[model samples]
Target: MKIGREDFEAFINGEKSITPYIETDLLAGSYSVFGVKTASNPNYLIKAIYEMYELNLNKKLAVKAVRNLFRSVGLGSVGLNNLLKKLGIDLKPSEFLMLVFKLQHQQGWGAPFELLEATDKRIILRTKQTFESQVMKDWNMQVCGIHQGWIEGVLMAVTGMNWFCLERTCHAKGDEFCEFVADQAESSWKFKAEAIVKGESAITEFIEHKPVEGTIKLIDDPVVIMPRFVFTSMMNSLKKTMGEMPAGGVNYRAYMDMGKENVEHYRKMGITKPHILADMAFTFYSQMGWFRIISMEWNEAKKEKTITLEHTVESEAFGNTGKNVCYCTAGLLAGIVEGSFGIKVQGREIRCRSKGDEHCVFAITNKPE
Candidate 1:
């Protein structure tokens, strides 16, 4: 696992391939996750989710589960394997890692993921402003569990060795830069993205069909793409943090404004017709992987919008929680309607997968005074 002296010489002699092995679809306003298009959410929002899970689960258990959940993110970068093989030159393991980390930086995972040091027993990696750490700077502990797991999975992929990746320091923990250390492992790993939470199963996957249908739209918004699990993990974390409130109240209230703020960009485009506005909103929503709409009813005279979604991610995240938990999504729809239709509306999740309903239903009607 050590970067041999010859490897260092190869790297220093300018024989390294600087070409990145990742592809980001900037025109489509998204990043490709194993060829599946994904949208971005605010980093602080995702940070809060990590805190929520930290609040609920024991530290060790949470770390272990998360490491497993994000393993796929690293393992899916098979492109790097091809890049290395095509070089057709003998390079040391450390050189390969250095190039791969540089590719991660190019792909926007960090400003620059640099190889700090390499020894017979360990390899040290460093980055100052990792997206994960930057968002969690208010905390007293490291928060790049995703990156740690990424290292573990990618190291295994490159070297065909089980490497245990650990965060030695983090910006969230008052460190100058987030640092990760990797050492060979004795095979204590599992591919369990659907780790359980409070006796319920977390969602294992979204977009059952690989390589989601149609080309990702060449939209006009800038995005930061990570694995789909990060979003699901955020929702699952919300369920844990809700604690005593009626299942969905906390989630519903905290994120209601998100939709309203989001719709403003579309609203300013001068699309006045309510149905057109709704269509615009739903297209953005669907592309973000929230749900696949089964039906949409926009009542003009009544000023109500009823939407039924078959693949509700919120319900899937909490698996059989025995009560309606798409309240956050309902609040989102309500806000979207208020902004899109110019009406004050009462929104409700009338059906939810958690309650064993086949389709999740949200009814947005005019709010009574």
Candidate 2:
């Protein structure tokens, strides 16, 4: 089906699913299966993986997740290879590499990644404006794991060879451009591959090397935000359809499950401290414009904590209905407390701005023995 701006808008509005819009046809080898657009915001994609990274604290797992995401994309690239075969473009190793570069640039992955050197055993590639570098500059770590996996996946799919892509330089590490080297030699690559598969930080070896200094203009990407009204409407609609059950039971269960998932995520990301986890949670929500954590107090002795969140737009938008309306927020807070503190805690929205209070207040207390 032909995708248009309306379809994209509908997708954003939660009125349509993206699956039907994905075009399987090779539109002039442009990877325009999603259609010809100048550029697309990757904030949602970045945020999802970043959240997973924060939750698991496992760099390798996060990297592997991104790699797997692209590996699925690489499966589609295999289909593209079949299309090229029919078009009389021979899938020579060099030609396939060029095809990868072309599709990468055409899809606006970077300002056109260039093949610096290619040999029988190794290949070198460079890009001045990689998507990961632009989006993850603040991360201060090599965030090109997706690209590494992607290159390996596509190459492997085409050549049927086990490939290893090492990111030698990353813009996230303050490099001017990103550089990657793909080696076909299994012996040289096996150690890092094994380490990554074992969920260990194999990226340390790549980042330890000095990066070359160069000058390149960075892309000024726009921040994307979900409309406040849309979010409120969705929440209100759920409340209306599900009735009191949603606020009292469903919301808690759903977000608590989300919390459990986040706990696993943060564990993988290697963050165990309650204070750090709480701070990270506040920052994560604040970045998404959920609410500002006005104050937080943790009592290690009592194993209890209180967090004051203010300017909750959700409550403000819906207004005071004479009941605690921030059920989802309350549930999320409960989950965070449980995950971070490693204890059963209940979050109660005792005060709400919707009910003529100064701000939404949540009291998190440990479950009694």
Candidate 3:
């Protein structure tokens, strides 16, 4: 079924029914998919990220970097394949790919998937609309890089070929639809090299080019912003680059710093109670489309707090991989508590959704004596 802005509005207003899978979570804050957490992200995030890249690099490289980032993190819709398997769609490669696309579409990844033509070596695909196009309609730039890279990754995984897809038309640029053409690459290395090369170039450009505004004032963060897919991809890239432990540590530290940065904001609002300040993040991030806070229990006498999150953004796209793939959020929760109380607090992920837990839970406590 097509979900329109009015539908979203009605759903938000409690005037319409929503999928049971996400009704409670959506009320609590955020969305979930097949027991995995997803987000109702805003369309502007694509533009915001594009702006970040554009400020440092040329538009071509900026777009390429975003595309490759998604490409490398491809086909991450976690538990859908298992569901598709029950339908006995595991035989034909093309059928497998199409089914995956269909499921992704249903999950709001994009519009319905239409396969225009398919050959042994090439395939052409089209979608009338995309989540990005809804916001980027007159931007004069093709902004559906996620679709381009996502299709390429899934094709490669299903066909065991180094598939590369190029966008021919994008609704973001006011086209009638978004179209992509995919073909096998000479080698997987050739297919993967683009991201690596462009990434290196982006790094150089980051240092050389003048940056855009460093910060912007906000009344409150947007309720829907970045996708869980992007969050998972970022964790994946860090894992690939720095190895799991270091990646988790670094990612944790960065977000902790980020959370601390909000100290002034909370102080300005005269929110001084650590528990209240720390509790506010759950709502803040929920509005930012991170995940739904399941439970928050605070123990004042012990100077500790524990949080359980049902919509695990960082782990939703990963299947039961048996790894602790979420940490940055833990740091965030802890950082806010520290800043709120102006005390040293440590955050730790006691349980992770990536490790097959039903929820991601963390704890913040006064630093050890």
Candidate 4:
């Protein structure tokens, strides 16, 4: 099953029929391991991982675990090896590293990266932005362990060699850039020190390095995003931690923030106004396989409107939590309303399929005047 640009784009656009197992196979190379859809908000995905890191209390162990998991998956059937093979590039060591960077960019991780140096014994790369760093910008921590592991995993899969990846500097640690060093040596501290000195001595050296020759151009294909299950599971984990307190409140606030960010993001793209933004939001969610929008209406006279969305996959899968568990969706809708109208509005999930309702429904209304 060769995944071409058209196929990839179709999959991202929800024009391709995807079963849970197949999607998992395509992305993570295991069959139904996640048992959910692929494609998700990167921020949500990183947050879930960060939460896990905090829960474990041992950042090293958490990072090691993540690396091992990613490595194992990358070594599996239909994984990174297969992806590289499909690209059909006869790449040198440096070119291969550049190819990896290109693949990462194509996957929508939202960062521009460069291969500063690559040799048989060592490789250095730098990025101004990274998904984890961008997501954890406010936190005082280094969150590049997963990425370090990912690089190691891919290298191992590609070269059949044990390579160690270390994050010498991180944006989360207040550095101007995130720097990664990979080598096959047992001692990585020396490489880390070198990277630090090099980064300081001539930062522009890395930035000004000419692009590698014969770079493989990545196809503008759709990325296989994560599924709703990933976010839902993370929410459920938080709920478990909250115990007696209602978890919906946390989800509401978090998702409302996300929605507001989405609005700001779209606004920069020249998408403003309630109706147009709502339609754009609906299209985005629907394309990501969240649910079908049955109806969306705006009542200017009553300062109220309603959106009826049905067949929400999250609600259908979790099945009757005895309360409206779609708080995030509600918050998102409310955020869209607020962003669109430039006024405060409230959104409520009046009916949820998870609560044994036939459809999940949301109501939006302006605040009391």
Candidate 5:
């Protein structure tokens, strides 16, 4: 059966007024046929699951499976463990089936972060700081005020890393920012602040930004707000739908310290200036030469900025950070900074660095509008 766009929209929007059976139909359409049971014989078990549960199982159920028994009743609303306790089922199949039910019934599925793509070198940052930090609050303003894209990046990185809403015990002066009250998704990650000052310069220092000669600007200044909005939406969606990772999964402190220390080391080694740093790092990693600004194409209508130049780079340096980990650290740094700042920094080529020298100076500056 063909599902109309409006019906799909209503289903996704959670308009409880609609018929619940349709949800089951939607799930059956998307996930009913998995292991190939054609006209000869259909997967009755799977069919029972759809008919009994009457829940949408597209991305959610595809991620996991659910049992017909528990979902048939109202037990589906409770936690997997709680539901198991209520049902008094110890079988492995029972537990697995419950997980499947949870996945199918889950309101939203899929990692919101996956939707994020690199545009004009925009990046998503993952930071380690209390969202309430007066410094970070101010830093956020600095980023969003100048570049709107960074707002979403900051929100996602901050909340995804579990630094959104801070508690009273959080160490921000004046309590200027409130703890993050649950947003629509009821996330625990939260913090409040009126301003974003330059955060612990040590960690945030890794963010690098470059000016492209040609920027596609929107006629009504829409591009200016695109990146930040995108980041914000993604983070909010994750907070609401995707719960937190395990306790020890993401060590924000470690990532922050490592990023800071690396940047400081680069600075000490004389990657002090932003322009120079960008030049040298790109050259060393991409093995490309830089020339002074020759020309720029700024597309205000599209909010895209492009810089044109010529240089040589090594192919190996641009490979992934696993086996060909030439510029892993540098590449990661570039991604973090670009994502956080919502800027683009690309290389035309790559080059091998001298022995005992695995670093280069990158120049970054916050150009005040």
Candidate 6:
């Protein structure tokens, strides 16, 4: 049946109107196999097709045209086979054909399965269309011919993130340095280099001969931005080690310090009970780590279904909160438990009076499982 965007979205979200096997088979085609029958629920199918294949469609109708032309020439099978082959998809011809038909039209293949994989590699990179196209157009008009380079610089500047290839001659000098010219084979670098090599000499000229105003402005950050630079680097390191970091590094760092200090200060006020500190951490202190208690229960059984962990956590307190403790207690415990014992805590709780608070205590919890 045809699927609409909403239906596709539902199916993708793990909504259960359909069976897993059906969903799995449909997604296997990369959502580019839609035909007469699957077109019945056009809306959901279309939605899924677009959602699943949308990123692939970023470049132009070129992909659609290519696929359609292949189909028209009785090479749709060949084209689908080619894509599936690239994706390492192995399925029977009948099974693969059914999926191919669903994907060609339905667009509801949301699983990040072969469809997204095929389309992302095949389409997104070559496309000039993106959410920023309009913004780039307006920016280009405003700054004369410096629009493209300027927009790229602005993007780097605004995001406070850096991208560089290992072998690039130039790298972001610092957090705010923002631009690099590297001769590397990374995907983004290749795109930039190829764009320069093939296109209007403007992009190449712009990069080689920097735009004075843009260059100066990109590097000219105030003194206040230094702490931000440090915090960003720290967060990036943390995120790389873990899977992700809190969305806002600056806000998260500030609050985390505050939570640490609140505990320290409270202890200085002569609080000594662990429960009080745990309560404080749960209500106030734990916010900094961007932590949320996933599941905390007293495991009474002899922990067979558990493991151990260990790691060093930079400790902070309210007074001069950014300062890391010589040795952090809670972080130490978590590292030991998760790393060595193979037991993961929903979070950690600890009591320390080193920084000043007498009854200061805190718990660091994992965001969620």
Q: What RMSD, rounded to one decimal, does every model reach?
A: 20.4, 16.8, 23.6, 22.6, 24.1, 24.8
Worst 10 residues of 3 by lDDT: 201-210
Candidate 5: count the clashes.
61
Q: Give the winner by TM-score: 2 or 4.
A: 2
> How good is model 2 by TM-score?
0.42
Q: What ranges in model 6 sit over 4 Å off?
A: 1-232, 235-264, 287-289, 301-369
Off by over 4 Å in 2: 1-41, 185-369
Ranking by lDDT: 3, 2, 1, 4, 6, 5
Q: Least lDDT summed over 10 consecutive residues: which range in candidate 6? A: 117-126
Q: How many backbone clashes does candidate 3 have?
A: 2
In terms of lDDT, the poorest run of 10 residues in model 1 is 188-197
- What value of lDDT does candidate 6 attain over all alpha carbons? 0.31
Global CA lDDT of candidate 1, please?
A: 0.64
- Candidate 1 residues lying further than 4 Å off, grouped into runs, are 1-45, 48-63, 87-91, 188-369
Give candidate 5's TM-score: 0.16
- Minimum summed lDDT over a 10-residue window in model 2 is located at 214-223
Model 6 residue 86 distance off true place after TM-score fit, in angstroms: 91
Best by TM-score: 3
TM-score (all chains, Cα) for each model: 0.41, 0.42, 0.44, 0.39, 0.16, 0.17
lDDT tens digits, residues 1-369, model 5?
Answer: 343444433443456322333323354554221121112123354344433332532322211123112222223223433443444543232223223322333322101111122222232222122221332242222111101111222333222321121122212333432222111122210110001011111111122233373343311111221332332343334446644332111222233344444444444544455544433333222211222223334457644334332211211222222221122233333443443334553311122232122322222222234
lDDT of each: 0.64, 0.64, 0.66, 0.62, 0.28, 0.31
Model 5, 326: alpha-carbon shift in Å?
6.0
> What is the lDDT for 15 in model 1?
69
Q: Which lDDT tens digits does candidate 1 get at residues 1-369?
A: 233344434544556532321247687776653233444446766566576666755444445446665667677655556544555544456666665555455445533667888864578888885777777666567777777877777777767777777788888788898889999856411111112212121222122322354332223234444464554576667658765454366667655677777667665644556655656666557656688788988789987678999777677676787888777688888878777777777788988888999889998898887
Candidate 4 has its poorest 10 consecutive residues by lDDT at 200-209
User: Tens-digit lDDT track for model 3 on 1-369?
Assistant: 333445434433446544643433546785664345666555677778767777866666666667666765565632344444554434355555666565456566655778888887888888887776676555577777677777777776666677778888887787887888888876432223223333322322212222363433223221223455776688789889989899889989988888887764665655566655655555556545567788889889987788898766676767568977668788787777777778888998888888988899898888965
Candidate 2 residue-wise lDDT, 53-155, digit = tens: 6574555456555765665555456865775566555656655765665545545553356778887768788887577767767777777777777777777
Count the clashes in each prediction.
0, 11, 2, 7, 61, 59
Q: How far is candidate 2 from the true structure (C-alpha RMSD, Å)?
A: 16.8
